[model samples]
Target: MSDAPAPTAETGTVAPPPRPHAVVAVLAFSGVVVSLMQTLVIPIVPELPRLLDAPASDAAWAVTATLLAAAVATPVMGRLGDMYGKRRMLLVSVVLLVAGSVTAALSDTLGPMLVGRVLQGLASGVIPLGISIMRDELPAERLGSATALMGASLGVGGALGLPAAALIADHLDWHALFWISAALGVVAGALVVALVPESRVRTGGRFDLVGGAGMTVGLVCLLLGISKGADWGWSSGTTLGLFAVAAAVLLVWGQWELRIPEPLVDLRSTARRQVLVTNLASIAVGFAMFAMSLVLPQMLQMPAGTGYGLGQSMLTAGLVMAPSGLVMMAVAPLSATVSRTKGPRTTLMIGALIVAAGYGLNIALMSEVWHFVLVSCVIGAGIGFTYGSMPALIMGAVPPSETAAANSFNTLMRSIGTSTASAVAGVVLAQMTTPFGSVVLPSENGFRTVLVLGAGAALLAFAVAAFIPRQRDAGSDRDPEGTVRAASGEGVAEPAAPVTRQG
Candidate 1:
């Protein structure tokens, strides 16, 4: 359909081509399994202090450790995947997830539990690595829907994990949760070993330890301040110190990156008008998406007597929200279709506008059970479109050598957006509370305010998407490395055709 595989220097023979469907299926499964880690412990978060015999504040570290670990691991793993092999790093990540789950499963104390969570967090690079794999191995036509399905796994796993975890926490011993995760990790890893192929599209160089260290320290500091600011008191010396250190360290890191020949992230490529603006929009879309996740569950679980609350159980709320994830999956092909015809820039703008409209509708629709379902489905469809298109926009601009690193950086920007959304939503909900007997809870107006903010963020994303430069010439998009594996026929399919010329 495209070109024959290029000969290798050593053997002068082409290896059997990878089965693109098997590769995509395995990688997507691995991504969804790894992403399940994000929401696995959420159902039990309220009882963590009691379960672990620790102060509520200390127990929050269970979640915070994973966030910090993921922030540090994601970009580093991507760089390593590019330097070494994506499939190899993917296996390593799955191993870490297995180990982390076993550790958490065995733990009776906070210390062991925290160790397990950090290991789980370290596995966060799986999704980006998986996307890079799809770009390497899949044919042009299959690539769009494949990448979209892989990206959507991030939300799919979280959405589905909630109800499953709630059901487990409700009936069985909580340790079963980690045990099942470990089992899923095992299945995912074994499937990967059997089905996925290691790509030869490597950046092959000495690891940039200094740059990696700088990035790790800077991101840890920044995320720590943002995540803990509320508990530590926003203006406290500790919080301020962390923020100041983050700002200074990141500034130095940016300057250092530009000077290094093989920096952790190529800021020049990142600064491309398309890459930069798409990343900006990614932040807003991520914020808007996570806002819905936070608001919907709480609103659904709140007491019915509160006038607007649905008075559903955690399991019920999760079930109510589950269809959104299914909707996201259902729309993957549709997203690829639109992206194929209109260009990813246009698709992203359409997605942002849809998300904005969904939020606007949510403001008026908050009173009914079916309303939550309908509103979530609308927003989920938008997310499906945006997530599918962002990677296309990114890969089109970056060379093959930088694919994993570039995609990982983009993923990190989304993480920052979600984290910031959590903080901002927490502040608003805290500030606008109503008394419910002995308990003080967020008022209906607080949720409406957050919805308004989400709509505004989505609008901001649409504005940013509007400014991304139009698609580049097909050949111009490739050959950034002066050569590509796709160009050489190095045992893998060419980029499912240049992203621009696909449809």
Candidate 2:
């Protein structure tokens, strides 16, 4: 064996210098910065109509645009990363974020704001790409915890950004929020270029433009229909038409993907037991995690006149949620350790059960601020475990060449679940309202119903995770040959071949 680290078969480039710790820190920081975009606009959402001089319906596009852009960009970016280079594509993503932030900071109209938000959304692939880079560059011993932290950054940034953004929106010019985001994006991009190495992993094939376009159209229609259903009236012709278009486009897209030589998503590999079940479980876990996000803030900020409302300010509600982000970061190591000892499947199942328990606690004990804090932290811990294990499960099943794409798809599944949760929760709260003077507030029972549904989603995730086939020990050598045999449902018979590393 050579003294240098081995080169991955897909990317012929040798691993960079042994700076695993620095790389992990930089990448995790970058992920957190990218995820911050998801929540940065929430503080300003209610004011968008007045601020932009647009109707409430059009102002809503500020949020919806980001969602649509992110949904389209994530998998496309992943495929590009796999084809060209992960770090290179990561840099492109961060640059887009910086540009978007600056544009939004300068904007006073809906059109420019939408443009900026869409650019910001393109960076959403950073987490999945960062995880792939970790797998490529880090030693086996360090890979697990590093990727776990990377994954956890998604939640941590969202949780932390809420309060940070609320504070800025309250105290300073609204434009200051985007300026701060721009500054953070600049710092993150600089660090990535300075510390992170470009992975040699490349599939080096023709870009799948047809598949990409089809998937983009299908996803936009589907997510748009689901997200705007409440606003457009679920039974309205517009909503129904969008759903029909989405289904038809996706069905055709699936058929095209099956026949393509180099498809955007590798359906065959994804069909394997491990990958399929993990993706399904991921959807449920995502739904469960987002339900608390939707319900807790409203409960926290509702007026005390209502019997069960906590009657806190937006800032306070954000502060209460902040600790959950810290808990998620704190649990990363523990989640990795569980995966190392018990397997990712066990880690996922444990996480699902913990989430269910957390929702159960929220349903029973949500009358106090401390109750919300406790419940949020518990759910955050569970999410950390589930998020950490998902990439491990995905990477273990797919070829090294397909790592970024596979991880991106898994992330997309989680997004779908969250979107679904938001829609369902919105409908429930809208229909189940209590009268307070002339105004209607979400009834206490409405919140409880949503919590119950959250618990159900977690339990469903646990059931789905239970079906994942047991994987080999993480410490074992993971050669390309072993991956092929495993995908074919055969026992591992050979050790991985060692390719020489230059650095």
What would the per-residue lDDT of candidate 1 be over residues 1-503, giving only the tens digit for each residue? 35344344345545434577788888888988998888899999999999999999999999999999998999999989988899999999999999999999998789999999999999999999999887776655666788888888888888888998999999999999999999999999999999988877777777888899999989999999988888788999999999999999999999998888778888887997878998999999989999999999999999998998999999998888888888888888878777776677887898888899999999999998999999999999888889888888888777666778889999999999999999899999999999999999999999999999999999999998999877732222243222233522243234443321110
Residue lDDT tens for model 2, 375-452: 999999999999989998998877667888899999999999999999999999999999998999999999999999
TM-score of each: 0.93, 0.94
- Candidate 1 ranges beyond 4 A from true positions: 1-16, 472-503
Q: Which candidate is the best by lDDT?
A: 2
For model 1, give the RMSD to the true fold: 4.0
Q: Please give the CA lDDT of all the candidate structures.
A: 0.85, 0.88
RMSD of each candidate?
A: 4.0, 4.1
- Model 2 lDDT, full chain set: 0.88
Scored against the true structure, residue 463 in model 1 reaches a CA lDDT of 95
